[model samples]
Target: MQFCDDCGSLMHADGDEMVCSSCGARVPKDRERAAQFVSTEKQTFDDVIESSEEAADEGLPSTEATCEECGHDRAWYTIKQTASADEPPTRFFKCQECGHRWRGYN
Candidate 1:
């Protein structure tokens, strides 16, 4: 067990230095030392969490529209909403494989 130099509390190995959990004190820094021992080591972590809203905003596929004629996947699609009695909804699609053109209004 190591003792803190500042508060004389028990210190445990936290990371790079012995830290006192109760008093929240670590090893004192020596400004006189310009360079010290250096080592290249890999750090490991057990768990990580990320926000899902960031993924959705990055142009990830949140929703997909399937073509009813040939069942083709598309990166971009047009959205059509329901129309009132005086107006009618219109959607147009052109297929490259079968050279088919279809449209619906109503």
Candidate 2:
């Protein structure tokens, strides 16, 4: 990555010259092999949680499954990729009342 010689901002490859979008400075023939190591490796979880306003507007699918904690008759359910690709997806359920979470392997 090349930096702007005028404003010291990051420069990108634009054909033969490195062009700075900040101050419009062009550094010619200084195409150094710079690896822009942006951290895209982020850990993501499959926890299906929704806000109350979104749930009220979109309306999550409710099941007749009872909550073990508060004995709520309805729950919001979603299928999640919890295991290997050869295996089946797990079903995650959350209680609407008590917000209890549980999963079932299919």
Which candidate ranks first by TM-score, i.e. highest?
A: 2
Clashes of 1: 0
- Candidate 1 lDDT at 21 equals 73
Q: What is the C-alpha RMSD of each candidate to the true structure, in Å?
A: 16.0, 11.4
Q: Kindly list the per-residue Cα lDDT of model 2 for residues 2-93, writing each as its tens digit.
A: 56878989876666777898988887753244344232335455565665653652366778889999998888888878878999999888
lDDT by residue (tens digit), candidate 1, 1-106? 5567778887655455657877998874333431353323444444544446433223332223345577654423233655665676665444433324455564
Candidate 1: residue pairs that collide: none
Q: For residue 28, what is the lDDT in candidate 2?
A: 71
RMSD of 2: 11.4
lDDT of each prediction vs. the true structure?
Answer: 0.50, 0.74
Q: Could you tell me every candidate's TM-score relative to the true structure?
A: 0.25, 0.46
